[model samples]
Target chain A: MSMVGGRRSLVIPGEIIVEGNFRAGLNTYLENGKIYSTVMGLAEIRGRVVSVIPIKSYYIPKVGDIVIGIVTDNSPTYWQVDINSPYMAILQVSDALPRPIDPAKENIRKYFDVGDVLLAEIALFDKLRSPLLKANGRGQGKLKGGILVEVSPAKVPRLIGKRGSMINMLKKELGCQIIVGQNGRVWINSVNEKLIDLAVKAVKIVDEEAQTRGLTERVKKFILKGKEKIDLESA
Target chain B: MDEEIKLIDENGLRVDGRRFDELRPVRIEVGVLKNADGSALIVQGRTKILAAVYGPREIHPKHLSKPDRAVLRCRYHMAPFSVEDRKSPAPSRRETELSKVIREALEPAILLEKFPRTCIDVFVEVLEADGGTRCAGVTAASVALADAGIPMKDLVVGCAAGKVDGVVVVDLCDIEDKYGEVDVPVAYMPNKGLISLLQMDGILTMEEFEKALNLAIDGCKKIYEVQKAALKRKYDFTEKLKREADKSEE
Candidate 1:
């Protein structure tokens, strides 16, 4: 009848987190009225709900989630993209661009050659089949002329911040176009290289300090102070 | 014609100065490899093993893909200089069989049904060996799997109990294992109280076998504590880092 852990408490696999009246969430499971943690994570308790947030893990692709991938292999019709997950996602030629192309006349490589970066969304996931990605959406295609900064997929939510507050702050203050992938890929495009670097630093700070309290303020100050220093030095 | 080998001395202490019911010092470190999804290094006494877990992802060789569950593949390898005699780089017959057994030992603890048609690969390398390589490897692989954030019912812990001379020791070192009358290695899930891997070599009476099994299980419980402690240490360190970040923000 008593909870075994408090907010921000760390727990390990098989560790009992609650004895009763709690629903397990995320990295936890319930058995015989007892909630148990299933990973090495920090415990979060919200009212009667308990969840464990994993500190380190691979990004598991989910349908409708946006992802950034590196094209690694190609077949006649599809491109194998590495999304920083255990599974390789396939982007079919039909989904690579907005319009269809003649298979016989047009080469698939020209559409999405190997080593290209893609900002795409998971279209369908039939278990046992390679994940199918749709890259035809607006702003979804081969990404170029920007820096790619990688963070932990689990911390991607923090990079986006509450209702996009943190990212919006970064964009409004720094004038950068930012795209965050659920697969832990962040693409930052800005006219100035200094602004892009500042954005990257902000993302890294979020990734490292996501579980900490007051992360938004820390990232904001870090980015703002960094930009001021850069401008001061330039002047 | 032969000199007597004393695995246990007159004071009832092991050659390494441990009691019969005592285990060797075990040190576990998680997240050692950057490229691996999950990785851990375990050093037990003089035995050192590195384990890395990759995937619950796509299965290679398309034919091997299981429609109903994920395939768990474990590779157990000993380095050329792991033992006194330089081992061959090739997988020996013993290594092949140990790999199979080790895989079976860890398979039951994972929730394979959740990741259908994928493959979870566990690679364990013996960097140094004195004794109980299989048990040490299993211990390291379990932590690596957990570190990789693979959901499971529980983490599997392993320990070896052997009858040295006439004493049933909790954990056996090289000298004791060589001269031991019987060696029983066990991998157990403490939460479920299940034995996943149990192997015995040499002779034992019914009573001795039961006692050895109990001892191995008890030893596995001790190992389970260390495993949980190591994981807690990692998470606690992360928590400390978060606290520092929060304080710096204020």
Candidate 2:
């Protein structure tokens, strides 16, 4: 059955959401004037565009996206980084450094020690090749002294919000510096222990209610209440 | 077995009291396993199969990695205690052949080229087997793959039909499969109206064969409905929880 003009309708794999004159969006496919869901998700219709937001999925690497990765293995010229994706990515010394370094003179592992977390950009991505990482950009490179919180990759967009408004709110209200990676890793750095806990809870809420309408307002209320509770405890 | 024991009665109901066009009761549950990327359990009559999907991850034995498309691997295994008589734990030749066909049946529906140099593994374990385990396995694996959020053109549903007591039946149970004239199993993509798997054993007249094929396709369409419902049930629960969370903010 066609589900055109339906708002927030539940869809499963192989169910047709629209027939003809509509474009398929994320987690959907088009065939013979029909848009079919490729995953179990909530279908949304806006104008002539139809899309399904999958309830669960893993991160897929894309070029120019910033991701938090942990170094898994290191070579003389490159290191294998785990971005929590199905494929392991390679971070080359050339892309990570401003200038090429001689492997004979310097050890690559020294630059990115095994198990070290770092923020990097996907410099090159091909389906057949492991994603290549570059960490030379501003606010990139090694992450230091912060707890890493993992959320769903699909919710990352919501966590960042429109033009980074949600993230800015958290940073301003909580007095913390937060970096969200497209790969679903969030690094929270702050001096106040209670504030860090509150930030974590707020991010969790955003991830949980990412699909809900008016979520930005709800999350703002949730974080404010959490902050109030922390202040009351301190007093 | 008594030779006089009729497989079909004068009223045309089979041994299980189902009409020739009626199918055995089937139930599907998705996301049954916590660890697998995708999992589903399908109970079709007396047969039960659990299928799990993993990866689109890096391929082991690097030489097996395909540059243009992801490799598809399937393992169809029957547990030792699943049957009346205990079977061997080792993969049998029958299982190896069924695994290959199951892979071929599902490969076309998946968007493998989108993720190359990786492998998508589907493991189908027959927890119970009365008959038509291969067909049930294919159906369950397809659901598991979709549950894993692997992009696919359509869901593949499988069903079996056979001649029992000189009549074509929609789905053949264990007894009918053993004494039936012919058993034909088909894996079909309902939306695309394409057949991915077709296998027949025994004999049938051309007219009977055509009739059996039509019956199995009809059965597959019914099965397609069940698969969609199972997935919808899962996501509906998720939506409900999200709404509850939103309401709590008031």
Candidate 3:
């Protein structure tokens, strides 16, 4: 009996394979073994087909990513942050350059306390697992003036949704500045305390309704309805 | 400690305008993950917890055996950015302790003897840390397990009550947690009506603690309803699919 012996023989989730040399039926003969092709498409198994699907995109730090991290001490060069997974992310001083600086400043804490929250991004994560981050970008910096909500780090993607539709909707509806730490902490800031509550409510709505189709519309309706009630009561 | 900072005024109103013993809004969803055996995301007040339960399957590493009861491993981790201050990358000592507490809390609720020698790993990731995370973890994990179809004595609902200033408050928020004098987190199996995990931090007068504990239990009962609703919603889809299959066969 011939057996398929390549990584391509296995199936990986969240991947699509196009243009194959195999036959065009629902089942394909690969390396002389019959393999089932999903009605959706075919995809190569880039990694071991683990239970958890691998994140396809380069890890971009969104407003909320619950990432576990460690402080690797600070330096004039950069403050190294070990965002627990293979990559080590860096919070560079240059990103915080525009802020006021003391010429004699030695420690970066004036900008970011050594162990303070480094809400950052994966600016560059190479094959070597070295990740450089830039907090200088909009909506990236020390999480302040808001409440933090923590959920399962793994669920961050579901909360974010395809193309940031989920979080953006929450932000727009609640009128809150939501910073999602890749480490899974979501910082919601708003002068209106009720807005903070609304942001939290919207997040929960998104989390619960992630799998549901047309989630954005549903969440928007929920928020708008809730807001209408709040507005009516105030009026 | 700022003595003047009041959680509740003499008018019987709270900082958030909630009456005593009222929980913040709660929402729950089950089977949220496509890969895990079962998964749930729960939001209680502002705190959100996502839990994934994998198996009563084979044990990894080929060792660590009990020969009878299934080995239950629980890991409770906070996202590095789950707090106002970005948290450290490593699972801190506190998270480890919380993980153990959650594991112990869930142990009794799961029917371990049924899976004999297999292992069930419960992974809880706290994307945000408001307060009552351990309790949230327990609650989320129980729902995830049930979603995964693991047999259990009952669903566990984790809840917390605390003495803020001098009065008891159910489901304390972050500010209440920072200013509050005492916090009591409790995990209870709503179906079986038993407390499985209990932990307290900060100082509470015995009467205050008792009041908080009772309030926490009550909160657990309330949350249990949400858990049941979420589970029902999760399985209802599958039931529909099964019915469709039966209809097609007929």
Candidate 4:
């Protein structure tokens, strides 16, 4: 199969991405063995599969993916969570708490009220029903305190990087606790105020320059510069 | 009829100094509206239109939601000041008809099956309407849909061909359309080789109709290139910003 664009080259919808035998991946469709781009963004050809990473898009929920969501409304059994997708996710009371409580006896809003934020995993999702969320997973629960930063859902993968190298680097260098949601919401927790501010700025930079080369190196330098200022202030 | 004034001169040039088969200058800008999910502004000759696309989100009122595919909603509105006499701000009978036709023209290009139980709304506001507003609206709305990152099989483009003074021409101005023998506006998907919208406003001979259709499709093909360029222009800026930062660091 011959690819029309080079690796990581931008492509627009209806543009021919590849010809001959190739698997049509996300943001692409197969027509008579030729793969055509369905979105305007960078085309990624990995082995036999070709997908285009869209430049700007809404988050589509996938089962088992961790996401940060805000509580929009609450019912007796489930609390509606806005995961930045077109579909609203439902977080059941049974999945949120360690023990079950009677719906009529206890107030569900006290546990997860409107405007509250939580980190949860998509337990189930399909076209038939709204996405179901379970917050009982590791590091998944109601979020409070430090900083909250949001980037494009498309850039979430870039911020985390390959094998968590970029995020791991930030954790080690800045000593800040970070949780990245597949839905483009990020929670940054640090005792130092400067570090939290720096982390927020760092994440924003990553969002803007997600498609760039040498991004990890640039972010490392930025954190170092920020750390120096914090140390000087303390001294 | 005001037959005394000539739309086409004896030199074979039209009122705008364009040849009979020539198209009007076209320009398109993508992502013009920030609040809307996706937006675009298109200018074809003296016509100026702004289109916006929102959702693929949950359908309101609940019952309107489609089980198998997303419902496509479209609105085509002309501003009160768009015409010389100041058209009504309310939706006229003509506006309602244009909205439905434009929606049908664009619906084929969208891949609605991917987003079930949702609705995608497209609004095309004719900021300045010279003529052929419906066709131009279709062209601009497709760009807005792409900007919103809605997956589609292909991009949609629209253009018009009309006959003035018994001569066929591609892309008609307001004066030509008003006085022309026939006006044909066509919405086309170039890659798919499909005609989504074809409407004739006046009487035409079989021979004249065939010529007008071919000319309109040709016009659509040329405008399709402009649409693709407008979409790329947004992303190219992001790439350029990254490259400049890398250069400064070195």
lDDT of 1 at B49: 97
Native contact fraction per model = 0.70, 0.65, 0.00, 0.65
Better of 2 and 3 by lDDT: 2
lDDT of 4 by residue, A104-210 (tens): 99999988899898999999988789999999877788998867788889998899999998999989998999999999999999888888999999999898878
Docking class of 2: medium
All candidates: CA RMSD (Å): 2.5, 2.9, 20.1, 2.4
lDDT values for all models: 0.87, 0.88, 0.68, 0.90
Q: How would you encode candidate 3's per-residue C-alpha lDDT over A16-76 as one tens digit per residue? A: 2333333423211222222222211122332322121211111333333434344566776
Query: C-alpha displacement of B112 in model 4, angstroms?
Result: 0.4
lDDT of 1 by residue, B1-250 (tens): 2478887899999889999788898999988999988999999999999999998877889799888888999999999999998999899999999999999999888888777888999999999999999998999999999988888878998899989989888878888888778899999988878899999998888898898899888888888888888877776756678678799999
lDDT of 1 by residue, A44-148 (tens): 888778988877776877999999999999987889999988678999998877778887788899878898999999998877677899999998999988999
Clashes of each: 0, 1, 32, 0
- As for lDDT, the candidate ahead, 3 or 4, is 4
Q: Name the candidate that leads on lDDT.
A: 4
Q: For candidate 4, report its TM-score.
A: 0.94
* lDDT for residue A214 in candidate 1, whole number 0-100: 81
Instruction: Pick the DockQ winner.
Output: 4
**Residue-wise lDDT of candidate 4 within B151-239, one digit each (tens)?**
88899999999899889998999988887778999999998789999999888899999999999999999999999988887887466
- DockQ metric for all predictions: 0.62, 0.60, 0.01, 0.69
